[model samples]
Target: MRGDSLFGDLVRAHRRRLGMTQEELADRAGVSVRSIGKWEAGQVAAPRIGTLRALADAFTLTGDARDEFLTSSALDDITPAQLPLDPPVFTGRERELAQLSASGDGTIIRVVSGTAGVGKTTLAVRWAHRVRHRFPDGQLYVNLRGFGPTGPPLPPGDALRGLLDGLGVPPQRVPADVEARAALYRSALAGRRLLILLDNAADAEQVRPLLPGAPGCVVVVTSRDRLAGLAVTDGAQLLLLDVLGTDAARSLLARRIGADRVRAEPRAADEIATACAGLPLALAIVAARAAAHPAFTLAAVAAELRTSRLDVLAGPDPAADARAVFSWSYRKLRPAAARLFRLLGLHPGVASIDALASIAALPPDRVRALLAELVQANLVDEPQPGRFACHDLLRAYARDLSDRLDSPSSRREAVVRLLDHYLHTALAADRLLKPHRGLGPRRPATHAPGVTPTPLADSDDAMTWFGAEHPILPAVADLAEESGLHTYVWWLAWAVLTYHERRWDRRDWIRWQMRAVAAAERARDPHFQAVSHYNVGYALCELGDLAPAHGHLNTALAFYEKLGNLAGMAKVHLNLGIIARRRTDYTRAIDEAETALALYRKDSDPVGEARATNNIGWCYLTMGDYTRALDHCRRAVAVHEAAGNHMGAGHSWDSVGTAHLRLGNPTEAAACYRRSLAAFRSERDRQYEAIALAHLGDAEEAAGRPRAAHEAWHRSLAIFTEIDHPDAGEVRAKLASREVPPFSLRQQIDRRP
Candidate 1:
């Protein structure tokens, strides 16, 4: 009466009934006493079928006793199913499992390839159990122990020995040579219709000798290596696995904890998936931890796993440990590729090939070749062309190795090189976008040639480049501050400001620029500090935070005065004028604009001078002084045209249109607004284009051209709403208030003609 007791306990219970010691059982079963003791204590499972039968015979057991022995020994039948019990919460891979069962596809072999912990072995076994009936003869599974905490991989001959035993071949009759055994294995499997799964093989060679050379049997091989040789030579169908998608990953966790609990706390489950990076093994571990403590919430589990990831992911079993699984693949890498793998986790996230080269301190071409090796090994992904990123769990593992393998100075230098790469390269791109921008001092002496950015063709290319790099820049600056590369902290932030302004990302501009100011204070660089505050203040003003915006701009003016930076003073003064105008303090706005104009003229900077003059006109138009607004705006336009600043000239023209409308000259107003819209379009400034359209509607309304007014206002409303601009509300109100016009503008004008 073994009941549900552990197999070892049942063996010990039955053995003592017959007065047998560990020594007596070992001698009778032809196994070591150590194996008997280990099994009884649950350190290992029962011995093989042969040993089990011997022990049964040695006991002289009757029917019930013999049946209990075979059942408890995991050898009730001859066909071995060493496939581990799959987790209860198994999910995803629906597509991959389907391909395995498509009988007519003629794919006898399927190589499930991916990085470590991607669930290759789990997939193979799950598919095998599903399709086991097709192979009525039997199913077979082996770990191969190809990449593990164990010593070398199981040899082909050893694997064949195990396969032959499972096929019911006698140990004494099994052939000694690997070739002969493989031949015998195939002969035994022939016409029988069986399934074999080789889990975690090192390469195709380890897999090939084990594949049954028969039509009916489907052989599945799982490995971290791509195993291209098998596909080429053995006609194996390769199934490359990737991490689970977001929804699938969450569903897997839901199935682990009760679906009710998971649905009630979806965020907690999402956090778990994010922390595990969609790896089934890590998710399973977290689920196991939760199941062990039924009262524990998933949030509590996530927080624990987040703090001590590797430690929590490591269970008692070596195969279950994420770190051990990673180490197996890492140890397989060549020296140079391994070094890059460890150092790459030091970077924030995805990066360009040149950026990685900069961190590695190697030439770009050499570094790219090394990276290709990692790509082939499935350790890293080229998610986008020229950009490489490791899986999140792998990144954490790499960080752990980085702390161990790389020296402190080496790690610090690598990060420094990375920061410098973004700083100098972004500055180069920004300058290309705005040719009037200043080029900073000669590139840092520490810069390797790999720090170079992609060569930008024009402003269009610059826009695409900035869009990709925007997320990385602030992170690079933060890394600089954390690593105490104080110089890079402010300088890189200062460099990216030009892109952020035109890109109109007010949040990132303000956040990163403020960090730049703090870093500049640490570096004790007043000029750069002034630049940071100036840029941040402008973004705040745009975002409509008048008070803090005023404070930052005033502080920046003080810094510029101390440095005697005329151009800096002119820029800050011009922005203060803009803020004043936005706040409706037209008098103060004009005064700030006059001071900025004087500074710009003193520095011989015509563009800055024109910008100041334009702001004065804006203030004048707001104050109902049409003649003065016209005079100043006309002067601004003349200077901007001479300087070839089309965008600036366009703004001045828009101001002139407002002035003419205030003077009751609708025809002249409409003419100027048209000029402004064309210029803004040429500059690709959608925000400004929307502004011009809105004002053009106002001018058309003043001219009694109702049809033209409706057209202009509707277009403006669409643009504003699309860009999420605050002015969209006002434009919508205007459109809503308008009545349908009786005639088209063309019809009214045609009647006059």
Candidate 2:
């Protein structure tokens, strides 16, 4: 702000003219009010590129006004590398990849269409990653969810919003109406050299609005449908991605299992490829099956394929034969492995080895051996180490097998065990993560035989466990709701609340909590209902959907009042304070926080009282009452530290540091921030660690230690980048403003900052 007086002046003037408080601007711009205050007060050298864009949109700045505001702050939008993780074992698509590479110039659309599970999306993603460097501006991607199990195809409007978001358009700047949003989207990408990969498109219509009107961007659309309209109207190059040829199919097997294994049984390999119908999905499963049983000759696998129900792998639909191929592998499994495989079908998404162990009523080591057998048969895929995922088709096949073979009572027992495993393990992990939060009393010897909940070592292990198991939690909760395990539903939701909040997975947070409410209603448990509603409300409030959030919170409050649940009422008041704080109503925030504090005291809940105290400190800090902020935050930190709640202490430490920094005590602030950073790192909370590092950088800079500040910011930037956080842009801007490039910490600090 010292170098950019005009930018600060304009921002302040614009805010005043619009009758906007700093908080209102921050909310609209998706930034913290602290940042807005600094930007307007000229305490910051320049706003981040993302912040500049957000401000422009918040003020509805257009034409020269937008350009002037942007350029004045050196607003250069960062390239968005949004492609998903590359296929770990992509193989046998050289010809298709070459064709895609040679198809058209960078200005054209390419449609890659194939049958289901025939690797259409895989090919598209693989190719996108391959040619990513050609489009220097950025590579963007979106899964349309067409023909996938998760949900329906993504609406064009939502897809466009995703693209615009990736392009760094502020949410406020994105038009409410789809047509306007599409226009804005096109405008944003007009001349950028970018790659847009639209995976699993339902049809041409779903993709049309997302396409850039101008031609510097190349659009790659993958689908089961041909999307002939795109080819007909948009002149999109149609690359009909058929099943892999014989050699490629065998090569895929070799890549997954081993070349020597395939080489030893060349005819068996060719027979296995033929049995798989040249479909990569089938081939992978078959290869996995083969690899798991390395001692089993390829001829044995081929023999099993020949002896299976299907007379031939050839069929009208490739997926149908792939199911047969799946069955062939399934039939060859031992009773335990086969049972484990079919039971896994009950899991909607990924399953950890522990979950599998519980589901099968087996010990972890026994389950691991069974999984190896299944994996060797290619019946399941270990996408990540210790985490298994069956192909969608294979999952359906397994479910079908379970339905036909397993008795109704047995299936129910397995499901109950699985639910018990997830619920109890989730509770344990949450206990480690948020020690201040009250957990249900452990029930002794309740779980069925062979059902063991995974034990985490500490908060760090809790985070790792949560990270691996997040995707499966919702599905488990859904299973609970379906099976009338009503208590499990709400408790499971409660268990993941901390993890979801830390990860900022708002969508799943809201979805799971809402489902919890429904399950509670079915059970007619007032306490469970109130808690679930409160969770939903809290999640919605975080998402900034204030009206509905208020509605849910009010409902939760009413339930708590009726039930005379003092502790529950206190938690509700705490969240109400948060809602009020988000609206810039500091007085109301403090009032609600005090109400929560009193209720917690009445309930004899010191942890809850500490939380309320910390919340009050945060509100005071936001209101610029730094002295009060310091006092309250210091008390909260003491309480948290005494309770051994490092996560809570880390957050309180940050507030303490912020208060110190605002009071011009940079040296003290740096110490507090270092403590905050250490606590978060110990808890393995990457997001908060980054936030502490950023604050530490500010303190170090203010303390006249530029090298330390740069190092702090560099580490902060690394975490933000790894997590794909929006704040990374801001951190980058902070470093750039200080003429510190984000090189290796050693290299950058070795040179003078």
Candidate 3:
């Protein structure tokens, strides 16, 4: 960073360290928030160095820090004013905006390039417009008209004339010679804080002359080419723009078409975005079409685009036509690359090189070369090494083309190979996640000649694989079910449920669980249907959707009883016991837990017995039967330890802590709570950690340390808020009541008796 801005940087850093917002820091410094923003933006103003000294004093800098602070802020740097109007449909470049903004520490030269109509110019213009106040000196804009099809791209010499003109140099004084103009332009921008946006450049050579040879000036260049030369020579940060995400795309459509109209057809909005591949250019054209025909339903547009994507995305302007924009890049690809791009449409999820290799019937090395060519052309993106996917629109375009270019049998064969790859890989990962399962292992599919399963070496690999593949699971399931692969459908959902269920991701759990239940019903397997109900019921119960949970659980119980499945019956009873405990029906809870425990013992399953014992001990703790709760909880802990269930043991330790607290043994209770907290933390179980923290606070208060108790409650409250835990309200209430006395109704001690 330039020394002139160091003080501003330091002040901003320290303010952030103190977790103060700009307004709060401004208040402390006895200045307007606008002043603080200007200072941080490296803007020079009239207030002189005293305003900066006030800022340093507010931040409480001392010694060398104070000396550095005063030195950095004392240098008054001119701000530039060089941005233009913003595009109407600007949305979702938050990450790129931050990157571009922070690149100001040194020479701020950023090159934004993507396929045509990817909103490269829109992003650059919007960002520059927003940061206008930072550049008080001046803002200069010059469009080179590269790829505009409006004559040829503007020459470098002519571009310099436009820039020099914006800098207010007299037209006759501007040199006719390109090299002389470049030197003059450099001299003009020297020591002046300026923002230079060289838009739609044909190439690096076109943009190279316009760059200011000054530290204070920022240059943003947009182009269709990657402009590798600029990055290699001038050290420009290259930001490759991709299609907007689904939510952002929906929001973009809503902006052009009325929000009320979009909301009325919310599904159509999402469908349109999907069909548009979240490309801003395509969405804008579709929105414009919708606007032109106010009576046309968005669903009709979505349906039309689904079959004729490239056709519907067309407009009067070549740039507004999504297909035309994509074709510009697509036409640049080699035959092999173009063929591979077309083949990707047949694959359901993102394709790994090996999967693509099998689908294309090519060698891995050969496939990599083809994919690299497509990547360079920006027609395809390799999000990770050896894994390739295209934006939604690109994929649709490819699919539509492939349906004609490739034989139907060939596409069907490619899909099967892709399906086989996922199904086998999922089963392998599921085995590592849960080696022992209620259901038997999924039998390996008879692979096609070239298809291979994804190999997961261990549990960690399996988990990483699961995380990477989870987003693709829903799509994979749909493909599997549509292909009449019912076993694969149910198995895929069941496997993912096992991996994620314990993590308590209620949304994904509920979604996939429903899919699994449907798949199981289609399979006409009684055991599978009952087990699917059990899985979903458990998830719903955890989510506090008790009404549905009760019906699912009861359905599972009846099936298990009819099927004479002792283990399933015992598990259902244990879950029922938990529901009873939630309602504080301790007597019924104990009865249900006892029945589960007896069945578990009869079945010789220590894990099931341990789970039941823990539930019963939890009930005793709730009833304030401290002595019995502690006894049962200790036994539960030992059994859980024997069964090697750390999470189960953690819950028991927590119950033991609560029992000790109620029995007036605060120190012991605190120690047990600490142990439980540590166990949950190691497991990364925030839900249980919050509960442990709340109980720990109770023990802290019992030990006469109200301050420590307050901290514990606050810590618990934050986690509860993060997880949207049901106990959040209670914790918030406790924190609020910490400084107040509350009315209490309690039974008087009858000492006379």
Best by TM-score: 1
lDDT of 1 by residue, 1-753 (tens): 111227677778878988999898888878788767766765543444666777788778779878777765543245555556764456888998888776654438888989888888878878877777777668788778878888988998899888877876656545566776676576566565777888888877888889876677878888888888998999888888999987988888778777887887789899989999998888888888888898998888889878988888998887788998889989988999999999998887888888898888888898899988888688988889989988889989998999998899888878877887777777667666566665546334456434545667766776777788887777777678788788787777767776666655667778778888888789888877787788788878877888898899999999999989898898888989888898888888999999999999999989888889889988988888889989999999999889878788889999999999999998899999999998777655667888999999999999998778899999988878776788989989988898965876878788694
RMSD, candidate 1, Å: 12.9
Higher TM-score: candidate 2 or 3?
3
Quote each prediction's TM-score.
0.78, 0.56, 0.63
Per-residue lDDT of 343-428 in model 2, one digit per residue for the tens?
A: 99888888888888888888899989988766544456677899887655566667778998999999999998898888888888
RMSD (CA, Å), each prediction: 12.9, 32.1, 17.5
Report the poorest 10 consecutive residues by lDDT, candidate 3. 743-752
Candidate 2 error regions (>4 Å): 1-333, 380-389, 441-445, 543-545, 718-733, 739-753
TM-score for predicted model 1 compared with the true structure: 0.78
**Which residue pairs does candidate 2 place in steric collision?**
1-44, 1-45, 285-378, 288-376, 289-376, 289-377, 289-378, 292-376
lDDT of each: 0.81, 0.81, 0.79
